[model samples]
Target: MEEKYRVLADTAVLAGEIMLKAGAETFRVEDTIRRILRTSGFEHCEAFVVTTGIMITLESSKAGTISLNRRVSSKSTNLGVIDQVNTISRQFCQGELDLSETFQQLKNLTPVRYPEWLTYLCMVLTAAFFTLILGGGPAECFVSAFNGLYFMISRILNRRLHLNDFVFNMFASFFMAFTCIAIQTLILPELLAEPAIAGSIMALLPGLAMTNGIRDTLEGDYMSGAARIIEAFVIAASLALGIGVGMECCRLLLQALV
Candidate 1:
């Protein structure tokens, strides 16, 4: 009994460490944990709040059978109880942490961080350039540009650049706004208005979030997915804010020219 419990705790600790290091995106971590616990027959569970996220601990001592103790602390905001259980099951069977990074690779949070604008510029350029290549109309291209720029920038910055989420978001929005202006300028005298509005805002689409959310929900992990869905909506709104500002700028400029 003591031996089994020790195994569970050690494996949980290792898995938690990997999730923190790799930025295991919430749902993946939770699922991994859930699997591990179920396999170990630790039926009861509770999570303790931690500054980074949650520390889930479980113990199940059924009848005369010894007992199983499962404990893990995860820093990721995304993983929920179900994921934790799954992780436990895998651990019980394999004696290895099943943790794998679902999002971008982890990076060291560093000094000498470039200004958000510079990071934003790189992101916008990546998106806008791709949009132009797709031969989208100026408006759609710009919309796609907004989508690509901010998200990719966020991904790189959040994942690789190791910046704060809010800081990255604000700059991504502003950069998207700035880049939209440039995009408007490069287009021929026509092809501006509705299409442009559509294009620039397309970056905020719920497609990615929706898919991930559904997967989590269907797997019986509701909490984490709900959080993800909320996050996606908030990000979409942020992109809209950028597109709106840029659209207003375009509108005003055209009015002056006329």
Candidate 2:
């Protein structure tokens, strides 16, 4: 009985970890964990979830007590994984899957991401089209495509360097803005920096973070919601600061050259 309870606790924690890591809201994580635990016929089951961790406790006279803590250090947006986990949880709760089967399925679930080449092409096109949508001329569209290329290169370097998020965003936006200014000065004087810079950074915006923050807040997970919101704001501020610095340095450099 004790071993069975331990396995149940482990299963619940594993599911919660995967969902949380895949960027599910805190409230949703807690709900999913709670449902999985409740299916075990425990007298008392409690699940606590935050942005970074999960804790679950199960208690019954026969099992005495069982608990688990899972620390999730990293997270990314993978809605596909989230949906799969949710479906697994639902199946387990509905008796379509036993605990062991459900656990194994969740363990083996992998995220399906786009191919690297497609992702890069989309990034380049996204910037170019955004420039056109923002009323930029053909030159701005052309320069923004190169800016997008630089942005993708920056992402690849950051993966190897493992830089902090704020520092990475700052450096990326700085490089993009500075390059845009250089292109305008040397290659196409009529290229508009504003639209090009704006479009180039659109791919880096924290739109998903902001949306998840709002949803979490609406779901009554205030702490996680507030934390996510603050994170989004910090990223935005870093981008703005980098752009301002880059453009200012370009202005001074051009003045000196004249």
Candidate achieving the largest TM-score: 2
Superposed Cα deviation of residue 225, candidate 2 (Å): 0.6
Give the per-residue lDDT of model 1 (tens digit) for 9-49. Answer: 44544454455333344556554544544545666644322
Error of 2 at 45 (Å): 1.6
Off by over 4 Å in 2: none
Candidates in order, TM-scores: namely 0.52, 0.94
User: Best-fitting candidate, measured by lDDT?
Assistant: 2
Worst 10 residues of 1 by lDDT: 102-111
**Can you tell me which runs of candidate 1 are displaced by over 4 Å?**
1-7, 13-28, 38-52, 60-92, 95-167, 182-187, 191-207, 249-258
Against the reference, the lDDT scores of all candidates come to 0.51, 0.88
Mark the 10 consecutive residues where model 2 has the least summed lDDT: 1-10
